[model samples]
Target: MGKATGFMEIEREETIERDPNERIKDWKEYSTPFSDDMMKRQGARCMDCGTPFCHIGMEIDGATSGCPVYNLIPEWNDLVYKEQWKEALDRLLKTNNFPEFTGRVCPAPCEGSCTVAISEPAVAIKNIEQAIIDKGFEEGWITPRIPQIRTGKKIAIIGSGPAGLAAADQLNQAGHTVTVYEKADRAGGLLTYGIPNMKLDKDVVARRVKLLEDEGVNFIVNTEIGKDVTGDELKNSNDAVILCTGAQKHRNLPIEGREAKGIHYAMDYLTISTKNLLDKKINNEGLDAAGKDVIVIGGGDTGADCIATALRQGAKSITQFGKHPQLPVKRGSENMWPAYPQVFSLEYAHKEAKAKFGEDVRQYSIQTKKFVMDENGELESLHTIEMKKTRDENGIFVFEEIPGTEKVWPAQLVFIAIGFEGAEDAIIKEFSVSATSKKIDAEYGDFRTNVDGVFAAGDSRRGQSLIVWAINEGREVAHQVDGYLMGESALPSVVNA
Candidate 1:
């Protein structure tokens, strides 16, 4: 598709990122693009394998490999290699409803399953995808095209997260009236508020939102369905309601001394920081992050983001701790291609942390037994001990503290990123909807909730998961809703169930 020996001749050229020290000076996005020529060569590195496992999106032999959203990887790579920017965008957008978001945030399991990644490094699929979209934006190819005819049905989406947005996009295209309700002040729930500005700019979210608005989707901000409006009111207002509220209840460490000022939930920290940044930029709100020792617990993406954010805030020092031991640089056999390798991986946040703090991550297996306190009920430090992995009574693996390995670390500020438990129960309870475990009670295959005319998708229904899965669930739920209202649907079934 590209230069005949491009794969062998030109090595993989990764996406360009700003230096950590330089990026920490601003809250804007830290990513830069490789030159057009570099992206083409990287695309050319896509091998013409007999079986392109990367795009299959299957659970084969108890080991998964492939794009979860079933992106047309090979076709788009070929188009990129051939320098067909417009065509590449078309093909990429066919499967992935939000390339800009995924290109920036998705881990790109497709690249891990790449035939070349077994020996050589994988082609930069994600970078190429981003480059294609950026060009689409630059060339003015991306625009809102409202449907010609209306189906005369209205859809109310409870959350404006990826899943809700995806469902609204598809349903709107099928000529349905889509209204997205966000509890936050903006259209994007997590994207605009929860995610730090350094990773994804709020303006970028605004841009997409504007396009959706132009495409005839109405967004209601700062409204909770059960509080501001009843679930029945939502049902009466719209032909269908799709729940996209993400799983947001922060998981607790449940140790003694949890009540302290400096011990903050990760989401709370991110939301406050983002709101401060936006208010300062637009409304002149005051916020600061200078000269404090920051300790982030839980070595997930959110933790990495907190580390990067603390560095940018001019922290005196930054340390990240994980409950588990360190991971290998590469995937082990049990964690092979297609399935997300449980092995270690690094993102821009880590690189930024390393650049600013001299250590990429100060991870620890033994962590806080309890939050130590100074005078007046303020957090000062943390007590800890060494931990080991052992089989529990059920023979399932568990982490436990060992005797005589106690230690303590200075923690001026602590951010916990232990992930979510499930969807918040308040709205669900007030709405009189039936929720069990993670998801709402609906038909066996349908997305309908026990409360008639209400449907749920994404983290609200599927629990905490990847953005790709949220988008897929949203698309599928939208189709089900469409059929329920109009007795038929033109929307594609993005998910089998």
Candidate 2:
């Protein structure tokens, strides 16, 4: 719906980033703003495909294929191309509660599934999205829309994450009294702590939270339900309770020297680093990575973040271990278009590591055998073995260690970024909610738990997922809760809409 021939005329230009080597010296965001003209050019690249799949918002081959929030990609692109910045921002806010977060961190499955991507590079939807919202903020076009009517129904949301915040926003708009509970001293959950500041600025998160507060959403931080406040108490006080606590129980490496003093979880490291930055504390004590050889286990976004954080902390050297082999430069046969492409590319953190270290820090096809410690039980080094991927009898892929490829590397600190299993057991049991080992027991479309007037959503119910998916569930669950309370709901369902 942009320029009919713009896709063919203009080459795709991505948002530029600050010099990696220069940006690693501080914690500021790496991405630089796109000029309005550049943004318009990028938005003009949207092709007028009869059937656009960029906003389909579905799964294919067990991976997210398009925008999970069901953003109106083409519509927004056309508005942006036509220089209607206000209209573009309106369309953007309709689907996404926080475009700022997704624009910075989301992998942009919409671009992967774009119609133009079948032949050439896709339209810069994510960058254009950021420009729209950033412009809205810059122009003072966005403000708190306090609901004029109150339904007198109270809904208690447990979690200040993307999911919980989105639900609170929607329910508050529907004139329900919404109070969000956060265990952390500050809200925004992972957005505030789990992710490093370089990827997403904490100020951006705080700005949204402040707007929510102005819009009549009550946020009570540093209060953990089931500990500071019992789940039953919340249920008795509120008309409906929605659990948005994310999947936070991290997977651990239970190998040799598991109890080493220098080893820590990636989230713990990131949280401490962010907290120290926010609190203006220079004393990292044992958690700081300065002058130490850092080894990060498990390769993912978290692992990459560890590498970047260690770099910023002035680590001597860094290495990341991954069980899987390196991905192909181009899309593999199994990973077709429309599914998020599994290809080799450097993330911002990886690029920073390379710029600082003069080589990529990631070491693929390597498995950590054990963490070796000194006589005093301090981490000294680690042993690893190269692995080969092979399919088993049932056609399941597995990594097999190559016996002769074992080697040792010196290290003083280690960070485990393996991933998370699911929501913590304590929360599930405290709420009397049924859940499997991996996720809470709730159907996707209907987020009801076993308890009456209770609901669940986001990573806690869907396992570890994208920020956009969390927002989607939050919006959907608000619709469900509103309908349950009033026997009808005017809130839009992301899935059904």
Per-residue lDDT of candidate 2, residues 1-497 (tens digit): 89999999999997799999899999999999889999889988999998889988999988899998899999999999999999999999999999999998888999999999988999999999999999999999999999999999999999999999999999999999999999999999999998899999999999999999999999999998888999989999999999999999999999998888899999999999999999989767688999999999988998888888899999999999888999998898888888888889999988998898898898999988899888999999999999999999999999898989999999999999999999998889988999988689989989999989999999999999999999999999999999999998999995545
Best by lDDT: 2
Q: Which residue pairs show backbone clashes in model 2?
A: none
**What C-alpha lDDT do the candidate models reach, one value each?**
0.80, 0.93
Task: Tally clashes: model 2.
Answer: 0
Task: Give the Å shift of residue 169 in candidate 2.
Answer: 0.3
Model 2 / residue 185 / CA error / Å: 0.8
Candidate 1, residues 184-244, lDDT tens digits: the string is 8888888888888878888878998999999999999989777898888887888888888
Error of 1 at 184 (Å): 0.9
Model 2: CA > 4 A from native: none
Candidate with top TM-score is 2
